[model samples]
Target: MRKVILLFAVSMALSAGVRSAEELSVDLMQSIEDTNKSLSSNIALSNKQAATADAKELTQMFAQVETFFDHKGDAKNAVDLARQSKELSTDIVGFVAVNNFESATTAATTLSRTCRTCHTFYKKE
Candidate 1:
């Protein structure tokens, strides 16, 4: 009876663990989707000959990403990457606002790199 109870307890714990992980993964994917939506919107605005609009969208997206990181738990590397990406996005927004396309492009490239790095590690197939 004791052995059966022990086994049942262990199984329950394992089930709960799996549920928690699944929840976390779902939340993370949602965060990524939100970030991607912002990026896409900004890119479209940029291509529409509206640099100011693009910069505003990018800034908002970066803010959402930061908020996502703030709510995350046990994702230290991801949080760090998000922070770095936010800085790059901020730089891009600033440069674009100033009509400095060259510098904005460079900052955007860096931001892309940060996204790729984070995805490669955290986004599993």
Candidate 2:
């Protein structure tokens, strides 16, 4: 009985870990898309405050992406891309904070490119 109880506990723990990992991946991807939309809309409307907020969210999301890829043992190139994208997001945040739409737009473009490049290698069709 004790052995069976132990096995059940271990199984539950493992399942919970798997579920949380899957949820994290889904949440991160959704967050990235949402952040992009928010940033684009805010920039187009010249809403510096909202754009800054969006940039901040993207920056954090990219960091999470980097960590997720690293933990998944993804290719080194993909991990590097994630890290580069995170850096670009930070730049976007800074640019938006200063109301520098031009620089922010450029950085955001680079961020998208990095994401596309990584996705090309790893994302499912």
Over 4 Å off in model 1, which ranges? 1-49
Name the candidate that leads on lDDT: 2
In the range 64-107, model 1's lDDT, one tens digit per residue, is: 65566566666778778877776776676677666666776666
All models: lDDT?
A: 0.64, 0.80
List runs of model 2 lying over 4 Å from the truth: 1-24
The per-residue C-alpha lDDT of model 1 at residue 118 equals 79
Best by TM-score: 2
TM-score of each: 0.58, 0.79
